[model samples]
Target: MPATPPDDPRPWSIFLIFLRLGLTSFGGPVAHLGYFRQEFVSRRRWLSEAAYAELIAIAQFMPGAASSKVGMAIGLSQAGYRGALAACLGFTLPSALLLMAFALGLAGQGDALASGALHGLKIVAAAIVAQAVWGMARSLCPDTPRRVLMLGAAAVALLVPGAVGQLAAILGAGLVGVVVLDTKAQTQAEALPVAISRRAGALWLVLFALLMVGLPLLAHVADSPLLSLFEVFYRTGALVFGGGHVMLPLLQAELVPDGWLSNDLFLAGYGATQAVPGPLFTFAAFLGTAIAGVLGGLLCLVAIFAPSFLLLVGVLPFWVRLRTRAHLQAALAGVNAGVVGLLLATLYQPVGTSAVGSLLDLVLVLLALVMLMAGKLPPWLVVVTGALIGWLVL
Candidate 1:
């Protein structure tokens, strides 16, 4: 049983606690989840284990930043709207401020060491992503057909290498699941209670869509197309389901074609993001910095993540009610499967193409995979090993 809600009239304490959490939690989403479980479930006894698990599922399924969404949900569970707001501010500010500071520093200097360090970081990124895919596949693709879908998606991504390819694979896999796969067991899966409200839901949906459509147009009108770049990324963060990897293509589509950043630069920054200890979404800081300057990085951070906060506040009141519906559960299962496929697809292109440049690179990736799958090393350690290998070999 969960503890009774604390009536601590001082919401400021909640803000400070999460603020400290945001600053100190250094691992990626998985690590952050562990931290939340410890703090909210074990320490405070604020929510039941089941409730915590349900929130994680919803956050993972909804997209944007998975850990951030989870943090927001935890906040809402404690002190309502004010609690959620405080938690978000606390969790996000630390990383955002740090990333902005880093961007500012990088903007002024063009060092050979930085370039070399980034090269190693790219290899680490590839290793970490590949590890994530393998781990997810073991859990999500237990059957032969699902494995086929995974391989098929990877092949399609390699062959087509674009947004269309990714979308087609996701849609195709979902259709197959809905039409052919046996969902009887899935149908019987327990549903989580919905806690968000209709008004909030409508507001979130509307704001998400408006930002998606309006930001680019506003950027065009303002004569600084880069603002459009920020807007597109912002919307992508808000609307994308699954997780950070799912947002990769959407981000690529927006930035690569528009000439905001070169492929090498974008890939390099992505690689570096893995090494940095925070939300993978903070990669937006790199993109923002590349586009305008420190301010651009800050704007991109706000634009990309603002919608996530809004959506959490808007939808959380009803999550408990909505999460339990059969159709919604089925849809989420399909979406989860699609997410696995998407990650598999991603591995071949930017992740595979950029990192695996030689036989040595292949060897390093294989070793990293083995460490991740068999040894069960934490991702950050794997990242460090990959970087060390790159530094020594590449």
Candidate 2:
């Protein structure tokens, strides 16, 4: 695809298209990219391969849900801020609504059938995530230097764990990138414009910063439930990387420890998300339903994802300068390596170990890998197959 197709650039049209995509798209965040490539790039001709790849690069380095961030950025490039909002809403809504129903549906029942379904869904999630880690590792750490960085990042992240450790690993990798990759990034940064004006970007950035700083203070002083809710979810959005898969551990630690929600409910909702289409970040909506209600679900959804949207919008107008610098590109290369390692480590811990327990699980996982890597089955199809296999065997 070379450019946005000549037809409708209308925001509602963008919204409607994404809405359909959201309803149909499945697998996980990485798989969402595949769906995006098929729809927006291959079918719709909305972006060039290079532009899509750049969005992926940017999403990988940023906090919050990476898939959602890329969606918003694509919308921004095509139409503007309204486009961004439309894209996000259309993409996010299907899963959000489904998750909300899952939350409500689970209120009384916790039966054998439910347990069987949940287990099956988890197996599917494991299989999908395994493919993601494998694919990312090969592409992101193709060279020896980057391979070394990936290993180093995995070691640290495995040892340290949690949001603090994740932040440190990513930040440290960027600095290491400066030293290890290239010394010639002293080239002057270029300026580029986007759908949003520089002034608007600056303003959005200031708001992001203000919320980051002031939300905590407001939580401390007033002790308001609304402020507290926003603070917790907002902080999670601002800190974690990777996407919904990475978001899981951080959110579990934040909400479960405080008794804000229960372990049973959390795990159930998590399994439920595996069955849904669109971004797994819609997992937020399920949590919201448990804690606050329907409105809470909506509020939490907004809070947890708002940082990503803000950061993408705030930076996009100036992203040309950053993307243009060769030295910076080298640094990003290291960061990308670190990102792969993080995913690799995560795959082993929560995603891999948690799902595969016996020989049956092992066989299923291998089958999943083959189908994803070689068989060329769509992820949702693979997911359905995995679920059926899980129900039968696991």
Candidate 3:
């Protein structure tokens, strides 16, 4: 048998490719992942479908932003450490810069317009989340058992409003999936290639863990509660196992009780995040700015997203090896199913209850959902329409 040729080792080309993705990839993490699959897997043929799937699996398992981690893994696999850094920096910088600019613009604005716009944005966000729940249910809840698990999780979440409940529901669903779902059909899964050095991986992990633990403490000592708020929010971003939206409850826990920002302000920032074209994590920038200032905004962006970069760098080399194990894959599948259920539950409570306050709000939400699902309009367009409806009605 002929020996298989080694994969391409060039760094510069990969850097440029990811740089483009970073600049133009929008519509939050899910949209960005779609773009990535189009550009890297389908268009460029840099990775096989199996390889891409494995990377996604690994990303979904780890804490932090899944899309960002997947992008970093792709870059690392293609061109080593520099490639990973370039990919992460390129993808994250555009949104961070834009959000920073937005914060600056909002700094001197009167409260009324900002408040109204934020209200409209929240309705749109609620609609978008509803669409997400519907789509996820269609895909993840393949059978009656899964649907029951999902509904049960949602019901539990409705009864108990907190991250702990969400976590419990996810874990419970995973246990159910593992115990009830058939695993006899499981087949061998291929491993993706790792490109980073082992030493580099260890270093990255250490750095990520240390920063997450220390940043908040440092902020506390500085006598700046805003700085501490930024640190906590950022740490949530860095440590969360899902994407930007998954970080919502974690952020709410940190902010709502502390009185750093009211529930309304936090929700407003979240709504505005949906209006933006980049990662939903940029909402942190808005919240940080609202809480502290430009410095807070900057700090929040860095703290929240920094761990994603580190995890990508740390795990990319080993993830391919790690994912091929059947037990691990099964565990991940259960976790992902749980994540879907949790997202579904979230759609009903804070998002649905807060946005659908009035008859007009309900109408706007339905219209937005129609535009998004039936009309097949882009999310940004639906957002604009929602805003117009909100302005007229509210």
Candidate 4:
């Protein structure tokens, strides 16, 4: 059984917590998820392990930055709309501000980030994600069938390599669960305190559809640069199924050819975004600032992330209710297993492959993992120490 939440935390408290996470939660989206699981699930006990897995499953099915969406969902579940906004702003602002400043020539981190410290940060990402995989696999994929499903999902994701493959794996797992997994065998899942009604959810969905379709048409008709910019980012947010990394090619192709930003500038912002400690979607802030200014950066940042908020708010109410159904619970079990698999695949490709190049890097990762799992040290501490170690030794 999960620990009971003490009380309804105020939005301010949620903001402060998420703000700290935004500052320290390095290593991109997969690593962000790991950090979140540690903070909210393991340490804070705001949600049960099962509930957290369900949130990941839902976020993976959505079309935006999965970690950011998960954060929003956690906020919304705990403290309603205000909490959701608070979480989004708190988690996104640090990197968005940093990237926007970099875009505007107010700060320079490129040369420094190219050093060994960055490599250590990458290693930290690997260790954190490895810990997440280890914990989630034990809890979510306990049985042989679900474990098989987990491995199969990982194989498919590794083989296929993209948003399409990821979505297919989760969807296929859900279908398989509905067929083969026994609902009676599944454990009871705690209900999420998602605060929207079905009618409200439907309205939000309708609004999402309207904006998704209407924005493009409005941009075309008005022939305004700002509207066009908003439309492009909004559409990108609505359409991209994977995480922030997947948005790179789409944004590059759209903005570069359209003359909104030079490819060099776009790539530079991307590199800076990686060096920061929040969602890679904050790259929008960089592009917007380069094109306009601070206001433009804020505009583009909100525009890109707006759809994610809408989709999560719209979908989660019904998702909360549906997951409790016996049949859906079975399917969710399979989806949960698939979510673990997706994380496993991510830990390998980008996290492990990028970080673990040498024997020393591998040793660093193993040491960090031990600290997280056995020593029970906080992830942020490990991350900070890893960067220092890399700066000194690597």
For each candidate, give its TM-score against the true structure: 0.84, 0.80, 0.83, 0.64
Q: Rate the local accuracy (lDDT) of all candidates.
A: 0.69, 0.75, 0.70, 0.78
Query: Which digits, one per residue and each the tens of the lDDT, describe model 4 over residues 153-261?
Result: 8888788776567767777777888888887532443566676888999999999999989998999999988888898888778755545654654565478767886
lDDT of each residue in 151-193, candidate 2, tens digit only: 8887777898766666667777767887888534333422212
Which of the two candidates, 1 or 4, achieves a greater lDDT against the reference?
4
What is the per-residue lDDT of model 3 for residues 123-185, given as tens digits with 9 covering 90 to 100? Answer: 888877778777767866777777787787777666777756876776777777777665332
Q: Where is model 4 more than 4 Å wrong at Cα?
A: 6-8, 106-190, 320-394
Q: Which of 1 and 4 is the better model by TM-score?
A: 1
Clashes of each: 16, 0, 2, 0
**Which candidate's TM-score is highest?**
1
**Candidates, ranked, TM-score:** 1, 3, 2, 4
Q: Residue 199 CA error for candidate 4 (Å)?
A: 0.4
Candidate 2: clashing pairs of residues: none
lDDT of 3 at 359: 85
List candidate 3 segments past 4 Å from native: 1-16, 28-30, 42-45, 175-177, 183-193, 197-227, 238-242
Instruction: Give candidates' CA RMSD values in order.
Output: 3.4, 3.9, 3.9, 7.1
